[model samples]
Target: MSNKATHASGASSDGAELRRRNVPGESNGSAVPTQAEVDNKKSHKPKSQSSILSTLDEYEFLIAPLIFTFLAFFTRMYKIGLSDIVTWDEAHFGKFGSHYIKREFYFDVHPPLGKMLVGLSGVLAGYNGSFEFKSGEKYPEELNYTFMRLFNSAFGAVCVPLAYYTARELNFRRPAVWLVTLMVLFENSYATISRFILLDSMLLCFTFTTVLCWARFHRLRHESFSVEWFTWLFLTGISIGCVCSVKWVGMFGTALVGFYTIEDLWNKFGDLKMPKVELASHVSARVVGLIIIPVLVYMFTFWVHFLVLENSGPGDAQMSSLFQANLRGTEVGKDSPLEIAYGSRATLKNMGYGGGLLHSHVQTYPEGSQQQQVTCYHHKDANNDWFFYPNRNKPLYNPEEPIEYVGDKDIIRLIHSQTGRNLHSHTVSAPVTKADYEVSSYGNTTVGDEKDHWTVEVVNDAASNDWTKIRTLTTSFRLKHTSLGCYLRAGNVNLPQWGFKQIEVTCVKENKPRDVYTHWNVESHWNERLPASDPGSYKSPFLRDFVHLNVAMMTSNNALVPDPDKQDDLASHFWQWPILNVGLRMCGWDDHIVKYFLLGNPIVYWGSTASLAGFFVLIGWYLVRWQRGYQELKPIEIDQIHYGGIYPVVGWFLHYLPFVAMARVTYVHHYYPALYFAILTMGFMLDWVTRPLARTHKTIEWAIYGVLYVVVISLFILFRAIVFGMEGDNKQWRHLRWFEKWRITD
Candidate 1:
């Protein structure tokens, strides 16, 4: 009975297989399809006439990026060489690039990677670094200015396609990607800044690439640990380092990535199905890829920076005495004594980062003590030289007296070598810092009072503190007024014009032991009794040099605040940038000279800002609906809400909001990075509003897109002259200026 039941089931299965295949089985058990099956398949296949269109549709991503990149290149490259003269920031950055070509070390508030690239461009173009690069001066006829400008423009042109790819990675629709690309390609300010040899274009390019790589990495979260996943994670890390190496503003992009990674890890931690080992692997991967990789890449850029710039230049004075001593062609510490003695004639440098040499001039202070002016001067001159002498109660400093090395807790008097006056302090209030006592040079070397006495207190010794003797450039000490008990300090405050606008020297009543402003070190010692120090002893460690340079950069950046005494017509407020309320003239305003304006295309700028506001409104509306128990969002919709809406919003905030607290002078170009994020938000909002219409009302969606494209294109064309460089009278651009605040013309 069992055998008969099995036979029946086998026969039924064979009948069902035959019916499904509609063909006969061969001896090898492979089905032989009938001619009709072949015919049916052929009928469904695409014809040769439509095959090309199908292939194009399949590779829309590649084709679209290529098209946008070509357009971006055209816009950025058009007439890039028209301005043969050094424009606004070109005067500064071009000189920096020359320093690199000459192998001369220089200082700047920004990082070195961008300027290094600029120098590379100049080197490739056979530039000799002969031109002074003065503002508004014409370039040398033999110089290859066009090639340098073209190199920088390449970075700006690539930004358009980077925005396109970033949008595609965010799952934006085709039209939205086009919108973002067009906005970046046609923006006037971006194009203008790229046409000159400046750092802004490189900064924008790296920033855009960073966001693109980050978006790609975020999408691979579900496939963690896969080859493609790890590839994107590493790329994102590299992009972060490159962006930061260009400018510190790149920190904003890094912060955006950090915020996302934290949220992602936190979410994964809550998943009950995930194994403990897997979670640990995820955390480890992020630490290696995001933290370690970026740090290494950032350090590599600085290493290259130090390697290429080996010779000392104008920036030598800005660095510590020990750091400068390591540079070739520097006179610092050459033929100078190692230890400072009572009769040593030396230049004292404030230990604070970005501080200057202790200086005094013959000019008397207009206020307070009306004594010879004592200030911190960045430049070196005879005025900076001072002679160390004994206190008034003790015998005067004698070169013959058994070489008495200046030691800790020793009473001394400092006399100006040129002015023949004693470094003096009094109870009068300081000129700038009212709470502090006044510091001035008073009394001659031959005649002085007790007010000139100062007690030396050693703060730190680079080698060892066992020896009480002070060493030049290695020991930091403080000068305490013997009578007033105030510490002699030189803060960042600038004195009035009467005092040569140098840093204010004052005596602080409170004793802050760690205050770097109060710390001083002998930089250039000239004592005949003491022997010269070993040159090898001045070698600065890389880590210490790196940290010290960064602190100096920060100090210099902070000193860029707007001056109350003068008005800067080119500077703009942070709020004015979003609204397009002002613009800057990039060169000479003469009627004959070519002029360029740093202003955005109004339609793109205004539209993107409005989209930012609309995003917040949409979020509020959704929260209200959800609170009332309406859960209408699908899985895809939720994903779009986060990646397209929340991500770019956070990026916009990170880049723009920090400027609100910045005390430095800002310009219109400062807003371009944040503008990139706003453009993304605009694209998302446009897709959000137009997507539903495409399914239900096709004609209305097409009409809306047509209007948008026309408006964006028309506005770009109207203000195109401003970017390409305008000439003739100011009235010629009157029609282009919609707002009075726009300085497109005089």
Candidate 2:
């Protein structure tokens, strides 16, 4: 119970469980499990602590992770409260934290879990959330953000030990654990991120814990229902939820868990002791524990989020009128009764697959389908509003006599109220979408013709007509272009500034009803007859609010095309991450005289990169030898060393490779997850490579490792000023800026 895996049953308790599973010397009336097989199962129980201490290996258990954690925290804490200035993304997240402290509802592209922690940290430290965390704005002297940095630094400290335990769990030797701990402690980019009020460090920390927990579970799965097995599995799920709550990038951790689960089940299925029917139980448990539990936790976090931020803030314009009504301070409409009518002026959002507001603007796409641009705008605007008509020949609605309900499948024409152009489509190809018919606002005359007519279809036939009726609060509707022989779709492609950067509206080639975004609810309705006091009628439920938040975040993320004019020199290319070629510009540019950079320590970085490559070669050689029967892999050694190397490599790629394909801007810190993976990989490989050398000449391996730590420590000392904030003349910065891309200013 002394170590972290006490729940998994300690080495002392493992004797009984090990005998139960293996039945030593009592084979199933046949060949007994070889010594190798017993070692494979028993290795999960770490050697007794007293035994390790007697031999001096206790330093690895007691000192390595702790020393590294202290080292990392000590390094990170140097300038924690020294300066109070807004830098890079701190302005965005810090401001979000402020809004949270103020109990104001706002929107973010990411889930609120990270911001909640940030705000909570500030609250704990006596921050009142009063400062405007604007770009280039210095923090007021009154706000002490030290606790915020310290909050994340605490997570970073745990990560140092997390790397150690995770590597050791893989059956890696003590040297591997040391390397992983040191790698995490000495990484410069990590050091800097830990010092800031950022979510990346927290994300990294949680992700590491998630993987570590899963690793322990994997090592102890045979002992089902044991406290350790249950605890690790439960912790794995909890850590997964925590990481994802911080950022969607945490989904990658879930992906890794999913893969591990499959591998687990697959191996169990082949076991003679496991009946095929038992596979169902395995799957069912995972579905509940891994899938259901994490989902519930993730959703619950949002529940807390929506509860706290009840007041309205800047994001009100990005949501439906009904959803906005729930936010305190929002000017919501009052209760009023109205009926569906042809002349009713209502804003129609795309009720197809893409959930964009049915919109039209004065500008036209320059290329093919050059009609007045009809697009799906995410924002609520006058341009998104439309007026329904029954072709030009039909007389204007006789409002005095009666109001006609425009029920499902009713033929209608939608005229863009702002542009005075009909929502028209033809056989011509859409501007950006291939093979899809073009859809645009086109009506040269004041009225629309056959080309403009569209058949109206209600999205949910089962839902109450009372809710779907025109002028009703957030009624869902769809439009089918009568002339184009196709349905309307809110295309995901974004238009240029000429079209106000909204999503394009395309005539779909098929009439697929499954597209969720195409399902639109009228956000704002205008009918003088329907009195302006119907706010309660438009109250959006929690699910609808969740959907609106997602739609808004997706659109915001998509619209993030890089603006060259706004692009900073600090933006790093995807390749620069591994080689430590560039780093973030923490404080600079005619703002703060002190400059800080988050570059990796070059020796650890380049060494890890080389180690990763060498590891691949080592694996290839081992496989070739095994195939030729020239070598027999020691099963016990394989678990701790070669196979152990795989988890981190997978993690590294899971985090790193996806960025290579990402179109959005990337920077060096994005590589830290992969960097952590590489460190673990190096740890496993070095332990394996040097074990023989250490046996023949014990001092050589320790000497090499000692040399490595010395180099790392020396580099950290040299780069400390740049890693932390340091003010100096240009001459001093030139020496610190080792790479040309690292723009450390005076």
Give the best candidate by lDDT. 1
Q: Tell me the spans in candidate 2 whose CA falls farther than 4 Å from its real position.
A: 1-60, 128-130, 276-279, 316-322, 331-338, 351-354, 367-371, 398-405, 443-446, 461-468, 533-568
Alpha-carbon runs more than 4 Å astray in model 1: 1-46, 463-466, 509-512, 529-537
Kindly list the per-residue Cα lDDT of model 1 for residues 261-317, writing each as its tens digit: 999899999998999999999999999888889888888888888888899888877
Count clashes in each candidate, considering only residues at least 3 apart in sequence or on different chains: 0, 22
Please give the range of 10 consecutive residues that has the lowest summed lDDT in model 1.
Answer: 21-30
Taking the tens digit of each residue's C-alpha lDDT, what string does model 2 give over 198-246? Answer: 8888888998999798877877765776777778888888888888888
TM-score of 2: 0.86
Residue 741 in model 2: shift from native, Å?
2.5
Of candidate 2, the 10-residue stretch with the lowest lDDT total is 21-30
